[model samples]
Target chain A: MAKEVRLWEGNHLVAEAAILAGCRFFAGYPITPSSEIAEYMAVRLPQVGGTFIQMEDEIASMGAIIGASLAGVKSMTATSGPGFSLKQENLGYACMAEIPVVVVDVMRGGPSTGLPTHPSQMDVMQARWGTHGDHWIIALAPAFIHEIFWATVRAFNLSEKLRIPVILLLDEILAHMHEGFRLPDSSEIEIVDRAKPTVPPDRYFPYDESQGDVPPLAAFFSGYRFNITGLNHDKSGFPTTNPEIIQRDMERQRRKIERHLDEILWWDEHELEGAELAVIAYGSIGRSAHAAVDRARALGIRAGLFRPITLWPFPEKRVAALAEQVRTILVPEMNMGQLVLEVERVAAGRCDVVPLGKVGGIPIDPPEILEAIKARV
Target chain B: MAFDYEKYLRMERMPHMWCPGCGIGIVVKAMLRAIEKMGWSQDDVAVVSGIGCTSRTPGYLDFNTLHTTHGRALAFATGLKLARPDKHVIVISGDGDAAAIGGNHFLHACRRNIDITLIVVNNYIYGMTGGQASPTTPFGMRASTAPYGAVDPAMDICQVAIAAGATYVARGTVAQGLLLERYILNGLKHKGFSVIEAMSDCPVQYGRRNRMSSAVEMIQWIRDHGVPVTRAKELPPEELEGKFVTGELHVAERPEYTEEYRRLIEKAQKAAEGAHG
Candidate 1:
């Protein structure tokens, strides 16, 4: 079969990639910058014998996805800003319960509904610590239309592979941008299915830590009966308040993602081999920084770019290694210095970390990034 | 011969999360009886619940169950019903969970009229959270949050369901266990949205706050105070004023949400195929 390269909007690519990745269920309330995802799924899912429900609100949207996932389907929900806030509790539940589902947050300006139809990456920190409790999440920020398609596939793969809710953090620009992308054939895409218990139904335990951190999920009506509760539960899914069990359970939940950091972590590094000035960025801002890097190189300033694909694990080891070789790191984002703090903490005083912050519903200008790199040089 | 209730009960799991002498236990037993009489396989049933004392009913049942977040059981059950319409889907929730925090979802689920049975265990208070006044707490009834006496008018959940378009709506109390069981079985059998409000007692919080200290006292209050719909209809307009008429209050035939959705999809598919051919 001939490879088909097509011009697609970022949202359409994401929707198409999700369908190819076997996402049979999507429950999301439409929101700006992200509504196209819900719209595409509304039209496309039913054609493939899938389910798409527009929930009453984002909270119910998140809840429905969790339930659909338990029934042996790859489910997801998309939203931006305030809708993301409404989903925190159930996101915590998905984290604690180890339910595999994808959450797509197309970033917008906010503390609360600040800018509905504009671009801002203010949710960087919130995505990591928005939900209560100790949970390590896999968050990927795609810079271009092509990356949105692949990042969505990666999000589903990471969610199912680790049994954690993976987030695809797309900004308004990248989400709504139209660009050309090479659509991979179904055979070319690698899909990950949820782990299923090999143990007999009588011996199956829903939260069996000894059986490995990621237990196989049995679909409802699969003749494998198990309890799934938000409360601290034993191996058989029955609630237990024992301190020792609770301690071990919390550790297992954290370790499931932390232990597999190598597979979960991803990044894009450009020209950082022997560069003194490094620009750290992600999402749409990362694309802007890439252009700024090219402009700086044309001016004969040795500047490089480091974009984190996995935001939660923070890519600390990679950042720490890169920090040693760079004299100064310029962190430019659409938010008021959120990721700069992480870069500073990880850089550990080895390099000077500077943040070029913006939060008034505007993307960071490429010229500003160019100026920051010029100054560092 | 009467069914062996003890065999159905998971002895090791008890004493349950319910408070001592709580009517929730009785209501749960009634539900189990209804399930047994219907002869539905435990494996084929999926009980989804939200946070509250009533939501704990699924924890005791020997079936594939889910204990979900607060006030979201209906949403979760909707997904389950859509995914596998062949399975029996029952949502167990509290007055607060169903009518307060989850009020919008409750109304919309009724409006959708999907094939699912919802048992709103109305103990008249948020029992699990220490007797906070719920949407169904009686007017002028004392609660932890409403120490000065609840001045606001309480919600009538059955009326809300009936108005919201539930196909079958009924009200029963712990005092009417056999009748409550019958209502639950009927609700389960109904092919659309079926709501059974199981009036229960919260002796620890609600009972103490409202001065009905004992579970037996609460049962007596329900028995003496509840006016049957048939009897209320016979009373004069003046005599029947200001009283709650409890029974199978409403039953109607309506197209279920999922069935209608399927029909629309089929029609669209056939149209597309016809157009192409």
Candidate 2:
């Protein structure tokens, strides 16, 4: 087959990639800047022998995906700000239970439904620490339509690999914008699936620690009948109050994603060879940051771009390395210093971390980031 | 021979987390007995529950059980049933969890008519949270939060399930153990949405605030008010006033959600292949 360049919207590409990545179940409630993903899946999933449920609400949507994923299907749900808030409880449940599923939050302005149709990267911290309790999640964001497709595919792979919920965070710009990109064939994509139990049905434990940090997931209806609960549990999947077991499981949940950060995290750097200053951003802001870096280099100032696709793990080590090479690091986001705080925490005393945050539903243009770059240089 | 509950129960998680003389254990045993009677494999069944005194029942069961968030058991079960139609999914939830916080899910699950059995343990008071007035708390009944007496009218759960289009709706009191087991078994056998509203007792949280203070007193109260649907037909309207009717309330025939979705997939795939051809 010849390579086909298709004009695709970011949300549409997400649904397309999800289908290719073996996501057979999607339960979602529509929210602005992300509804197309669900709408597309509604028509597409059934044709592909998948299930799509428009749940009663965001909470139900999140709950449904967790349920479907447990039944040995790759499932997902998409939402925006307010809906995202409603999903936090079950999102935490997925974390504690280690159910592999994908969640997409197309970012819109909010503390509560602030901007429904406009762009904002405000969910950076919400994606990291949205749900209550101590847990780890892999959150990936994309700057354009092309990466949105690849990011969603990677999100499923990482979610399945680590047996955790991975968040694909996109803002209004990347979520709604139409762009041209070469459609990748599913056969060429490296897709990862959840491992099934190697033990017999009698010995199969849902949270088997002996298997590895990320235990093999036993299909719910499979003869390996095991329990799954939000409460801290032993390897048997029965809720436990034992102190050592609790600590061990909590640490296991954290290490499953944290220790495998090399396998879980992804970022791209541009023109950082002896650059005196760097621009750090993600999602749509990274798009502008990349353009700004090029403009800075054209003006004889060394400016590098460090855009993180994996947002939750925060790419701290790479950020610190960039901080050392650059005298000042410019961190621009839609939210007021959410990721910049992490950047500062990691790069503490290594360099100056300047934040360029814009609220009230507007994208930070390249010139503003370039000005930050020029001033720092 | 004595039935081996240990065959189906996760005995290690015991002593099970339920109050003394709580009705949840009876309901759990009835469900297990029903499953045992049906001879379904533990692997072929998935019991899901919400957060409540009743929702904790699944943790003690040997099936592929899930203890989910409050009031969302049905929604979760809906997804599970849809994805794996081969498994018989069942939801066990409390009154407050099912009708109050999870009320929307309860009604919609009925409307969708998916193949799942929902056994709602309607204990008038919120027993897990120290006797807050629940949606099923009869008017004028006292609870910890309803010290002045509950003002909200108690919801007729079976009526709502029937109105929402559940294919099978039945009523059973936890006090009527064998009868409740029969209703649960019949519910599991139903093809579409099946709901068994098992009126439960929360002696400590509810009974103490009202007239019935002890387990015996509460069980006696449940039995006294419980009217068999067959017997209620013979009683006068005034005599039957406020008396909850037990046994099967409604049964209907409808296409289940999962089967309908499968048909949709087959049709969709045919159309897609035709279009490609």
Candidate 3:
């Protein structure tokens, strides 16, 4: 039986859910929209035998999470625009080193601190490619408070399962807004622990591909002595400058995520049985788009909504398949047409791609989306 | 008869990468002595290091160790400590790695006051990358980049750590071998963020660039000029001016970052469980 949940702000729910998930280490600096996460962790982490640190800055916060993760703890950090920018370098290192960590970016208006307290979906590209080099990134965006809790849990599970960093992309509205969330009973959720090598210490190779794709992690002081590095490394994890080794290693790192695409991609479709116009969006904006699509349908328009939960390893095939059914696709984002370009590329001239975007942190009003959808219809 | 320190040493690997009579060797010995005194199971301690000549400390030791990227040892060690707070995490880094590129992390680690011991070997210049002036390079020190001499003054690491909220802050020199051992041990025992800045000699790069030619001469200079904070207090300001004050500068107690966080989690859990029950 589903019980009525009292209204809870998205940020509070995320913080509460983090505590429930057995997250014991949170190192972050305060920033707008995301400040509530740090504040909640600061007050809540200690009550549950967890550690909360407001680092000197975002770089240190990132470093601390990596440190905490290595110590065999589930660790996370929260940040916004500029702080996210400061974290890219270490984020790349975490990916290359195969460290399991969760980084929450409650994105704000930016280029450089453009709108500290406002919302923007401008970080989509940065979250994917801001870090140097080629590496797989798992990013999830939640549309509501309950989703924040579930998404954070998913972030941790994916991070440990893939042995890579997972990013939870929240916007200002969702991170700061209020919504009731039902806390899951402990038995309801499945938690995944990092894989420990079953091989004896003497025979263990840190990065040995013998496991097929995902290698087991040997915790420090485990008597399994094996090298770990950020450099392009062989299965033994020692530095290798060989081009073939570098190429193979990079592909393997990417393939580990790409090969599991079936389990990674997620989306929701609304009223698209025979739609001629499709509206695509994500994060908080997706919620608004859903309402706008409903309003359009009441006015005799064949407008539909498609919302993606997994932003990267993008559901290109799904979008392309949908494009074949629709004559036009409208993408509404909080940025200057970032996701729209992606939709256009995937649509591949089969459909008209229209971008409805706003800068300076103001969310695209539902009416603006409705009008766009109505015009397309 | 000196317990045959050489037996434990990696002899074949010698013709050490460090210059002749460098103080790093003395500091490493002191560290080893402290580790021995603690009687920690070697398997339970991980000596992590970042890129620098001092970073080589992990490679020569038999314990589980990690040699990480430049200026990121603390970051890596933080992960190691959080993952297993039961294990001893000792981070050995140079002035450049700890104070320059890693300055932000250094300050926050002090502020967080987690249970970790950081030994910063301050040679006052970027030795491994060539004699570039570092955040700790004294004013007017010549370096590859500062050919005209550095106009910016060096940062006092002990003062910075104290200001940044470290529970334990101390300064020692490799020249004072016994004192250095005591300081390292004290830092290890502090139970929170502890920083021991061992003023070391980089005779090869820093000394050559700044005109202090030999490592022995550098050690002798530190021994003659380094002033104890207690004794220096009696001396006039002008007399203590320009001299490096060496000793345990500060110690205090506060709820560490991890402990405080743990408390919050327990409280939240109790409230939730109570309400549900």
TM-score of each: 0.97, 0.97, 0.89
Quote the positional error of residue A173 for candidate 2 in Å.
Answer: 0.7
Compared with the true structure, what per-residue lDDT tens digits does model 3 show for residues A274-354?
889999999999999999999998998998999998898789999999899999999999998887888889999998999
The ten-residue window of minimal lDDT in model 2 chain A covers A1-10
**A1-377 per-residue lDDT for model 2 (tens digits):** 24689789889989999998999999999799899999999989999999999988999999999999999999999999999999999999999999999999999998897999898898889999999988899899988888898899999999998999999999999988999988788778999999988989888888888999988998888778788989999998888889999998888888887789898778888988888888888998998999999999999998888888988888888888888888988898998889999999999879999999989898999999998787777
Model 3: residue A320 alpha-carbon error in angstroms: 2.6
Local lDDT at B9 for model 1: 61
The alpha-carbon lDDT assigned to residue B65 of candidate 3 equals 68
Model 1 C-alpha lDDT per residue in residues A1-377, reported as the tens digit of each score: 24677688888788889999999889999889899999999877776777888999999999989988888889999999999999998998898788899999989989888999899988888899999887768888888887788889989998998889998898889888889878889988999998888989888888877678787788887888677888888777878899898898888888887788898888898878778999999998898899999899889888999998788878898889878989999999998899999999999999999999988888888898998888777
Q: Which stretches of candidate 2 lie over 4 Å from their true place?
A: A1-3, B230-240
Clashing pairs in 1: none
Regions of model 3 farther than 4 Å from truth: A1-4, A223-227, B1-26, B59-72, B75-83, B111-113, B162-168, B176-179, B213-217, B227-242, B247-277
The per-residue C-alpha lDDT of model 2 at residue A279 equals: 83
Full ranking by lDDT: 2, 1, 3
Calculate DockQ per candidate and list them: 0.68, 0.87, 0.47
Estimate the Cα RMSD of every predicted model relative to the unseen true structure: 1.6, 1.5, 3.4
Cα error of candidate 2 at position A77, Å: 0.7
